[model samples]
Target chain A: MPGIEDLYREIILDHYRTPRNRGELPPPAVYSEGNNPLCGDDIRIYLDVADGVVRDVKFSGQGCSISQSSTSMMTVAVKGKTVAEVQAFVRRFKHMMTLTNESETVDESVKLGDIEALQGVVKFPVRIKCATLGWNTLLEALTEAIK
Target chain B: MVTTLTEASHNMSFDSAVIRRDFPLLAKQIDGKPLVYLDSANTSQKPNAVIDAMANFMRESYAPINRSAYTLAANATEQYEGARAAVAKFINAKSAREIVFTKNATEALNLIVSSWGRANLKTGDVVLLTHMEHHANIVPWQMLQQERGIELRWVPLTSDFQLDLTSLTSLLSGVKVFSFTSMSNVLGTINPVEKLCAAAHAAGAISIVDACQSVPHSPSDVQSWGADFATFSGHKMCGPSGVGVLWGREELLEAMPPFLGGGNMITDVRLDGFTCAELPAKFEAGTPPIAEVVGLGAAVEYLTNIGMANVRQHEISLSSYVLDLLTNRFGDDITIHGPRNPELRGATFSFAFRGIHPHDISQILDQSNVCVRAGHHCAKPLMKIIGANATTRASFYLYNTTTDADTLADALDSASDIF
Candidate 1:
């Protein structure tokens, strides 16, 4: 059995307590919301994208440590990255969260940084949705920004 | 014999320690920790008697009921009907024929909304509901409103979490049907069913009580409540899943059309049309959950032996212990979203702790084998009213003791430390 320590690492708790880029961006920033109806974990991602790059990003939501921390981490991870880079990073982040036997061989081209702390969330299958709620909302916001 | 046993147990002081021994799951250990199950509001842990009854029935007298004329089939039918009779007696219903078996309480509520709501209600017809109702009671009515253009009105809550009945008269003015939960599944507020039903009747409307949360924990009398329809799930009362009871006034059941059409729900059939079966059978429709019903019978018998009055007494005491422990220890840091009085609520406690998310709290508690439900608890409207996206709910039952309550408090301490 995976212990609680694995799921709630110090890095994760730190990120949850003092989140980075934790405010909403006003319009002309593309915005999207994601929620887990089961646990009532809601996430909203705001993105300011220009010239195929995410110029700025912020997140505002209320959820468990995994979700809120992931959202906070997500804003920092994608803030200065191009749309393509952020999209690829989202795929890799989600890949880490997936329950695949081949998860050990995740593409290491992009550094996951603090987001890798959420890799432990996959052990608790139910919290996987929590750890990914931010990224999913980010993807939605990215789609809206590009369009 | 059952009445004598129930009365005898009621006089004696309720002993949860002795009662805990009856449920095999309470003895279970996870990760070197004894399981402190406090999610009975979700689904109860079945006693050994229910488990054995179901297993023994399947092993000894397993046969399809009501179809074959064979001796085995006859005996199976007897046991199946016997379960229905037990459920009727448990709830103090007028007759077993008034109890219609369904998949679960959701299906039971759906049966009422789709069958009775459709036949009785028209466009612009009003169905008054309470704010604390489970989604089962709310969503079906909403569906009816969408399809038939019926109006849905809600009875809001007071500042202290109890139902605000001050405007119930005006709310029921134009209501053709008034449906509400006998107890709030989230807040643990026990509604005045008899009073609500009387108010509904005074306004010339029928009452449907979602007794899912109340029936298992307390004494239920459909006749006394003066309700037209009442529904509850067996699994929430130490019974197995896949079986639920919908007790209705016989006349109304007789008048309404069958919800499902298949074997066992009809008497005579033709290519053109079919005649529906009488009372309960008309609504049962399919080959019922025979073994689960038998298990439910055992569960009803177990509760009857212990007496629901005693069960309610145990919960009251436990609720008081939990309330004092959580509030006194946490102080302003913890916010329990229910009536402070034990008499006003069940042992179910939906609380917010130190700004910690309910999911995180429950997750940390799970490390200590303290099982609790964390979410909207299928009462989203009440969640919104309480100003929480979700709340951590720890619900107790007849088998739980004050020690379990203490364990929960200690676990909350650890959760705060982690967060």
Candidate 2:
């Protein structure tokens, strides 16, 4: 569980306590929502993307710590990245979660910082969705915005 | 089981201290103390009778039942069918031919959707379910909705957790089937099955009750309830897992097509077409869980000996005790879900602590050897309606006691402090 300590460790607690970019980014902008009704995880993700880059990203939702913290980390990770990079990061993060056969090379370089604490989630198969809710929502928002 | 334990130590009666010994898994320490098991609603622990029934079946009658001519196969088939008869009698069904074996309640539900539902429900036919149904009851119908364009509607829960039939009058109109759970597994709400069935019957709708929660803890009579079809699992009672039952009306069974087409379900097969077997067998394909069926029959006998009335009384009493203890101990600090009155509930009680996550609560409780189910428990929409992300649930059975309630309260008190 070495990499796992990165996913569930205390630093993630700090992000959960004081989530960065945790709110709406006005109406004329990107919007997306994701809900894992099973665990009552629902989130509304909004991003203010200017040109090809995400100028801002934010989320607000009610869920367990794993979901809320993961959302918070997702906002932090995707705020400054390009739409394509955010999608790739989300794809990689989901791969890390499912740890399925295809997701061999995870986002090893993108230091999610304390968000890495969620790496422990791979062991707990069921909670993987909770750990990646925000990232998924971000992807959805970007997908809609691109279209 | 009772005999050996009684022989080892002359103690009988439903005492928590003595009953805990019956559960072999209860011996291990969880965190630093005795583990408090609280998630029986999702899946109850196997008592000695259930475990022994399975073991005895495996050791003594280890042959495939039905569709064979061998002597051992005959005995196995008879015993397996005898179990089906036992289940039929348990639920007051007319005959064992109406009981189709399944892996769990989920498959039993799928059988209806795949067989009777697919054939009977046309496009635009509405499938009405309650909002409090477990995912098992909801998802299969969702498939019908997705694939066949069948309309799906939910009967919302009353403020106190039971179905509010009064509010769903319009929704019931034009509905072909009224499928719902007899009891909420997460909320522990004991729904009024007769009233709901009466409503559905009046509306010219077929009723399929998910009696998985109620059948194990209380006596169920499909005829008495007037339900078109009812489903439950053996393990929820004193039986082994991997076995479920679908109690349908003989008319429905005789009419519905086979869900899984395999060896036993067909009487004859040609390249162009095939004829179905008989009632229950037609629905049950492949090799059924013969040993588990036998064990489930033994389980039915075990529950009958104890008496279903006694089991219900014991569980409701325990639930009241648990409610009293939780209300007194945590008060406003924790939010207990479901009705306040014990008469409205069955064997489970779910609660969420303020300023604490249910996962954290379960993790802490586990340290004290208390096993509790945390999270949405597959009742996510219900959780949303209740305004909580997750909850820790404690369920009851005939074997549980006031002292176990006390131990749970104490450990939860500890969990409260820790979280």
Best by DockQ: 1
* Chain B of candidate 1 vs. true chain B, TM: 0.97
Query: How good is the docking of model 2, by CAPRI class?
Result: acceptable
For B1-419, candidate 1 gives per-residue lDDT tens digits of: 01235554655956899989999989999877899999999999999999999999999999999899999999999999999999999888899999999999999999999999999999999999988999999999999989999999999999999999998899999899999998889999989899999999999999999999999998888998999999999999999999998999999998888898998889999999999888778887778999999999999999988888888877887898898898899999999999998888988999999999999999999998999999999988889989999999999999998899999999999997887
Off by over 4 Å in 1: A99-106, B1-13
Please give the CA lDDT of all the candidate structures.
0.90, 0.79
RMSD of each: 2.4, 4.9
Docking class of 1: medium
| Local accuracy of candidate 1 as per-residue lDDT tens digits, A1-147 | 689999999989998999999888999998999999998878888899999999999888789999988888888888889998998888889888874356454556988998888888988999998988888889998899999
Model 2 per-residue lDDT at B337: 84
Q: What DockQ, between 0 and 1, does each candidate earn?
A: 0.80, 0.38
Task: Please provide, for model 2 over B1-419, each residue's C-alpha lDDT reduced to its tens digit, 9 standing for 90 to 100.
Answer: 00133322432244555556767776666434665666667776776776787787788877886667888888888888889899999999989888889999999999899889888998899999988988889889889888899999989877887788786668789889999898898899988898888888888999999999999888788888989999999888868889999989998889887788888888899999999998788887899888888889988987787667666766767888888888887889878789888877886988877676777566556556667788788877787778777788888776777877887777777755533
Real contacts recovered, all predictions: 0.79, 0.52
